[model samples]
Target: MFGESSGRWLDSELWHACAGSMVQMPPLNSKVLYFPQGHAEHAHGGKVDFTTRIPSFIPCWLSGLKYMADSDTDEVFVKLSLTPLTQENTNALLMDLEDGGDDCGNNNGGVVEGGNQEKPASFAKTLTQSDANNGGGFSVPRYCAETIFPRLDYSADPPVQNIVAKDVHGNCWKFRHIYRGTPRRHLLTTGWSNFVSQKKLVAGDSIVFLRAKDGDLCVGIRRAKKVAVGGGEVSVSSVVEAVSCGVNGRPFEVVYYPRGSSPEFCVKASVVRDAMKVRWCSGMRFKMPFETEDSSRISWFMGTISSVQLLDPIHWPNSPWRLLQVVWDEPELLQHVKCKT
Candidate 1:
């Protein structure tokens, strides 16, 4: 039966050429042959099964020729074929339409390394405001809270394990545990489980921990289901915030980077040259081989600013992006949790 009850003939070339392969144009340079014989007895729904294959393609080709072709074929196969009359003619007419619409965006639709159009801006702004409005009040730097609680080593630790945490929006983040070797740092890392519980992370979520220059720890989330790179699983190698054991207990800071934020702010070469002198809580920052890709917009805490601000509109100004401040209780208590020297 090949998983189709409508009696509509399956088109393997139409689906494989468009949905199965990541290459958009299907490498027209090489010949492609799709045979109906492949699905004649496919009991598990075959290559032509609409249910399984359609959803898989949706995430892969979010916006490309494959996406376009799928949409067109779906319309004809699912709708026009049921028409009162001239169904064949209508289907033929639609197939004649050539593909277009690649000019308006990038390979991943609207994503371009450092580009933040609207979502990240809104998330950042919302977080900042909520944190400010909390009952215990927003989180301040460790230096500012010293009077309320005693300070710990706040040094960097080699990542013990890699974990993934995701937010409600379905974003994926790869996190590395840098608080290894001692019970104190373990407690601190364990405390992060609260975020996981509150956010309801399943087995596939991503959670990242970052240490900044002043010993402040930042938390980020990415849903597990959305992560597809490197076997679609979490690993310690993806950690960008690696620190030396000798640097442990010396103070560090945490910076939160949202998705789609922009490259101009993230990859400022001049700033990396003078990183030691910078002092800020969370804002535009860099990670990794800073010069490799020009499109990564970085977010972290640095400089003298107390809050994250919209770094002016470049790619999408009208729907401008901003940072979100998180509201948390007992910032002083969390700061008191000491780490071994």
Candidate 2:
């Protein structure tokens, strides 16, 4: 006997159970990379310097929280502290330029603005022994060789091109680029050794190159962090202190500065999905990480999200990643804005 009342009650009960189990998950705070396309490595063997293996235009994305566990009644989260990797944040982490403090041995011209104009156009490379030695040549990444450097005449036996670049000090140097090797790698020859000698650069230092709005190439340097001191073993505390410090209720330091600037700093797709689960709204209080120039330490900047704006509709329409306009309590730092998950 088919009972209409029983069937109706059973269907209703099943619908309610399904609805209860569909409770939305909270947004996850995870790290991600924004890797651009077409920047793949060709050579692989020996001790590969992963730093050099990074693609051009890379920037690190550091979040202030990490996921722990979830419970039915309450969810658990862990606070994560990270340092800024971009040059502007690195300058803030290493020096105290804000209050007319001393410049912390930065050879690169005063910190340049890192807005949209600079982030996409700039690239960095860590110097290698071969780059600083009397070998008279330096290896150039494939992406830089193809997109950033001048065009090469492949018809020639070796396919060569000459590039004139200006350092932060406004000094110009000419470098010759040649495509050679079994897989045809790009190398900077001729004047590379001269530039290295003039700059007094050594292995472990980094060279940053930026294409100015005027179409001229500009270069800068970032010295590597010193590990050993006075024949004494490097302590973990000293290493942590070298990168960040707390002062006036703020923490500043460099967390992860990659050897190259690549588009890979964008958050991963899975991380984005987790982040989207959270219902974010304006006026939310958050602690953003930044580096202080005086100590090169990582610090936190407390601010409230003022508004959310979509990416340029011309290029990205209805994009899930939105720009966040953050207004810090300090008026001087009011202009800082970041991308939201």
Candidate 3:
């Protein structure tokens, strides 16, 4: 294992280029809609069988929240504690939805508040074969090197300097930044290989570089999403446990690996309440925003709701899962969506 400093200097908020910035953190102490079936699709890679009954949707309160990063991959995740809303309140919301009323929203609604500041300079690059291989060096994009890295003393025979940066955990990393590759390009040597190995980065995975206003360089990563071989059972089992605990009104924790491209199960209550006012019916067309698979850009997908019925009405009555079947206009892109994952 690589050593990590037990200190912090870099602001975690500035390191959002990878995934955090793409989606807002569900507001704290707000209402959210938790969809177990939607969560299962991402966890098991596709549709899964569930012997135990799972609710279609659980109206929950965001009782607790904490952001975390995987020690190995540096992938950011948010841990959440959710408590189901009272069944009485849920029924009232359903009644309001059926009545097409929009006044059911409560005042406990808003995003988490944070002090604003000048955002830092950040660059993201998808690791190429040469960058992730055993080259002992990483090819840096000219723009990134020139714009984000410190001023290089090109006067020397081979413009090079020692660069010290910190990872998400505030662990310091050093590298030899040089502008002397074959094509007169920038490169990271001396300490690049160790970072690759320790982070277990691959060609498809991405590395994010950030330079705070105080000139502290920070390194973060977004691991490529892969259907883990032999690990589906484990993920599915854990998700099921969380859903069970949540549906029973018991507090449960969910660790959301942001890069997984999973549907935001715990969605802000304000947004959900707004959506609840929609007269959802068959043939209703709608568009929703999604992150590109590369996490490089935001895009929209338009679809039409084919039906509005519970996925399993008998066993999972009033469950919101699969309640709406939509056909996307861009059916081809449906198979692959964002995360570089």
Candidate 4:
């Protein structure tokens, strides 16, 4: 039903927001490589001394993966335990694990399962340059307006209405949706620019609009990696703190930011083993399965492997970190891919 399952069009929002949405534990008893150098990158200026004390990577066995989130921002991170496997030497694995994990880590009773879960009508729109410009207006698609939005009274002179939507952080935003213009289309005119300015939204960032079961409008944001502004949302102190906690044999957490720029200092053992079995080389095309929402719908991002090279051949010889240079179908969404000039 994938063909008909999505009411969403080819806009990049649905793909960015819901695709690969599930964040799971890195299963206990699995073998993994912990990269202290990569972890220090996130700690950029924090001068995390763990990088020097630790080798480029440490062979370890996954003891735990407890999912959690920041109380302030509702961002998902994982509390994990990795014990050093002194028997296995470093740089033994030749392929890196996929940097994949996604979840809001709500303290509320985990995720709601079963197909009977309420799924209201939803529409996602990626703001165009015009929509995010200084002009205070966000153009609304006709289908979205007629279906997900509240009905309008055409009899009114200008046919205008005030709409309120809630963000992931539970903040309320009001927009003046109006029907006016030569061809007569729906647009969020009054509060659109204000929302964009406050959220720092740009052309590529997506705004998802939906009708809740309670009949209220809900809005969510999906930011592309480029908008991360100065690396990413992970702070220098936070990265150093997480790695420090890990070294001290206490549970530490890492963020699940699945972008090329954000390297995975923590990864699933099974995913790494499977990837290591592949003899990846130049000119290999593959479809990566990325699930979202209920975890039932599956979407794939097509890509071609361009070359296989060591990220740090000098310091970490034969290390698999970012070893494969590839071109993804949606190159604009990733930062570290090999792009043609």
Best by lDDT: 3
Tens digit of per-residue lDDT, candidate 1, span 233-313 = 112211111111101212111111112111111111112223323443554332322110111133222222346443333
TM-score for each candidate, following the candidate numbering = 0.19, 0.36, 0.76, 0.58
TM-score of 3: 0.76
Tens digit of per-residue lDDT, candidate 4, span 1-341: 01212122222222223222433334455666677667656554524553535455555666654433223322223445666554323233332333222221122333322123645676667678998896668999887888878998889989999999866545689999999999998999888889988877777556677677677677765554433332224566766665565565554445433332445666655455556668889999966555432233556668999899987676667677778887898966432221100
lDDT of every model, 2 decimals? 0.24, 0.42, 0.69, 0.57
Clash number by candidate, in order: 49, 36, 9, 0
Greater lDDT among 2 and 3 belongs to 3
Q: Which candidate leads in TM-score?
A: 3
Instruction: Say which prediction, candidate 1 or candidate 3, comes out ahead on TM-score.
Output: 3
Scored against the true structure, residue 196 in model 3 reaches a CA lDDT of: 89
Worst 10 residues of 1 by lDDT: 53-62
Between candidates 3 and 4, the TM-score winner: 3
Task: Give the alpha carbon lDDT tens digit for every residue of 1-341 in model 3.
Answer: 11122112224464355554566766577667788766776565555667776667777778876665555456565667888888887787667656666544544533253424555677788888889986568988877898788889989989999999878787889999998956798999999999888777788877888877777888887666643432112266677788778777887777565566555667765566566567789888978677654344677889998888877677678765555889889877766654344
Between candidates 2 and 3, name the one with more favorable TM-score.
3
Whole-structure CA lDDT of model 1: 0.24
lDDT of 3: 0.69
